[model samples]
Target: MRALGPLALAVLVMLPRLTSAQFGLLDDGLTVQTGREVHGRWASVLHLIPETGRFFPAYWLTYSVIWSVVGTRPLAFFVVNAAVLASLLAMLAHLVRLAGDTRVAVTIAAVAFALSGPAVESFYTLSKAEPLQLAWIALSLLCTATAAARARGSLGRAGWTAGAGVALLFAHATKETSVVLAPIALGWLVIERRAKPGHPCAARFAASYLGVAIVSAAAFAVLRWRYAALPLGEGWYTRAYAFDAATVGPALFRIMAWLVRDFAFLLPLVAVGLVRDRTRGPLLYASIWMLGWLAVYLPWPATFEYYLLPFTLGAAWVAGIVVGDLWRDRAVTPLAWPTLTACALLWVSAGINAAADARVQLVVDRANGQLVDVLGGLPRDSRVALNMSPINEYHFELPMHLVEMKRRPDIAFVRPTTAPGHQGETFLVTPEMANPPRPTVRIALHEAAVRQDRAMLDGLIASGAAERVYETTQRVGILEFGIGRLLCRVAVAPILDPTYCPTERGLIERRTFTYGWQVHRLVHARPIAATMRHGG
Candidate 1:
């Protein structure tokens, strides 16, 4: 009986993932497999090191094991991600049902969440930790509820409470954002207890869970402070000293855009239902859940859009309630216009998600394979340096490393020998890196060094030390991207790189997203004296 509902949700939610290519990205995306563990050896998953300002031991361990055991290109990463995503959806629906919502409400909740902006972004990276983290967090809540209602200060009660704590710890280990759930879990236990009046209150279980949460929180705080207070990926993540005021504006923009784009049609119905929102228990729960996430996320330094996955879950629950209230009554409602409008908006959101899921396939993955072919054609022991585009965000190095590891072991991919003494060196430069936008940002970071690097690059190419051996360019311009936007509205990532997308710009200004490149080599073996002119 329960099988068909979950199965249907699985297929509905995973349709985009199933169709999109599942290769990993260079940074925190699926394929970031360089030095996954301490000294390339498998450390325990409980390794307390706060790597890159985040305590994701489970995340690191899981990826490390998969990459090491299966070699660099494990296609099965997609299969595992699909299963996790399906499980997440099933658990979400079950939780809604447990909250005393109707079956229609449960279906609505699962569908909205599965097609949300966070869902699209999280599941796009095969086996990304966000979806898995959410799954564990939900399970932990379920365990807490079980202990609160069913256990009466017995060993079984202790067991259930401990299970909840352990499950929550797993969530925190997966992604530190899950730490926010600890407080929510403690209070949620009270609500669960109140639901069963005849059963004595599980105060002892709650106290045990509280102790666990307190110890866990202190441990994470100490580890993070001792290790991660240093520099991590970008400044706002760890170096900004917990937070700065400037981060919140762009963060809110990204969050609101995601909410509106995903559930614009449903917002009206939510507003319409707001009068009764004071009385409805589920609505209150959902709203508080969303507020809890906001309380943590808005003030915190990490501003990535996918961090809003928890917030999106809360919003989806609220959406489910609104839809459930108005599913049948046209006389009462809200979508000959309400239902029809939500379906239309949902279609657009789904399209956006599908497009995001398919994004890497269009450029990076294809570049990886083509680049492999290009490197394979080079002579044995050819000295090559990669001069990537400064503006190019994707990690193109992984594929190059894979080439050296798997295919052309003799081709030495080295740091650019721009210091002037290295001979017979081939510089593989992707011209798209030289391209810059209108510089709409009023204040940009690190202006001097970046200009110097670009200028030196231009000087080397102009001096005629070497010529381009081969090149393949993929046509990617503004019009095709515009068509994509017209098809499905975009949910912008909350990245602060002014060079890529300026926050102040009025969204959608481009003749080209990027001109994709498979670069050729420039063999330059000359003194470095000729490459110092500095002009843009």
Candidate 2:
């Protein structure tokens, strides 16, 4: 129990490098940090525009500082992300202890939280703001707990309260969903003060928290007004994918289903803690924290797995409380066996999911490495057109930045639209303009897009419009498992290449799962025109 915290810290410190082998600065990483060069100013990185309504000024500033110090080294970014995640995990353990959990329970729950499927995803995609948001949230909660423990009306209490408020502001700045933290903190304080009726700092702490929320809100509004082209309701990105009123019910259902599917074991423990410790102020605070995130996510237009990070933390804390109480009793009952079994199964499920993710990451890393090699081999003056998904572009951008290439000015990167009947137009790869100075090199990256636009790729190859420069291939193994069948599924799935069913007899399956990239060099005009005329 005593060594678990240190062991967890050591593992977290290495997690970024372990899981991020294939990851590169892409999407928000580029749009928010490296890609700002396209707009010719640092202000572009702020992204106050309505297209991205989530104004993360603090996040951008942090990246700017990193960029200045590290000059776009991918490892530097990974280190910072790992550090933040480790800090978040440490804070989570401290929070569990504050809730009166025993050391063993705190260690177990914190380890579970770190290994939770969603947390693994966050670690893998370290470029996103979710980890940073989690860090700020944990920090705020820790500050609130510290303030609650301080002497009434003392400077220590006041200072901790102010720190909590500042942390809350940064959390919101990292992600708009963190606005729930303010109310969560207030609720926690209310519960704590009620438990200790004579606490002199209660009123003052509440008022200070409220003042912080008000100031944060006002500051956010001013920034939005000054920089955003439209309000949240008017933003295209928000309306299209994030928060559509018409689809809220279905979205909420899907999100809930996802939670149940991923965290079944942890959810039951949380429920037990909530019922068992309902009267305890700290337990109530944990419950409120978990519920607050659910309330925010229910109406969200899209509920990505990463959105479950905060909820996972809350659940872990509650589960820790329940386990701690049980451990203190020191009695093994009939129900204890099943409870222990469920916990074991939960961890096994998480381990399997993490392994699957790591496998996919390795495949991606191989593909990205091949692409980088091909790109590096191209002529220094080549003007290449990138016709791929945003994710693929980000993968490419990271390596380019690391190598400090001067190709950004010459590269024409286009993220294809997924709209119907626009597949050909999306690539813009025609035989007519297959000449120099107009993308002499074209790369078909991302397997899904390649599969979708196979005809276009075939046409280019057949028409002699372009010659294949490089290619690479890899296979993906998909794992399927359910309750009471995980161990069987793991044992049989890899060896037999079949969907493992615990009871079903001899159900073998085979599927083609290959992903890679293909590069083509534009041919001279004469051959291209002749090939096109003959409908090659």
Best by lDDT: 2
Clash counts for the predictions, in order? 5, 2
Model 1 accuracy (lDDT, Cα):
0.54
TM-score for each predicted model, relative to the true structure: 0.74, 0.75
Q: Given candidate 1, what's the lDDT at residue 3?
A: 55
lDDT of every model, 2 decimals: 0.54, 0.56
Model 1 agreement with the true structure over 176-211: per-residue lDDT tens digits: 766666576466456546654422434443455556
Where does candidate 2 stray beyond 4 Å? 1-25, 28-51, 186-215, 222-229, 239-245, 275-283, 330-334, 385-408, 412-449, 462-465, 482-513, 524-536
| lDDT minimum window of 10 residues, candidate 1 | 436-445
> After best superposition, candidate 1 residue 483: deviation in angstroms?
16
lDDT of 2 by residue, 387-460 (tens): 33323354356435435433334333333222233212111221111101100011224333444445555776
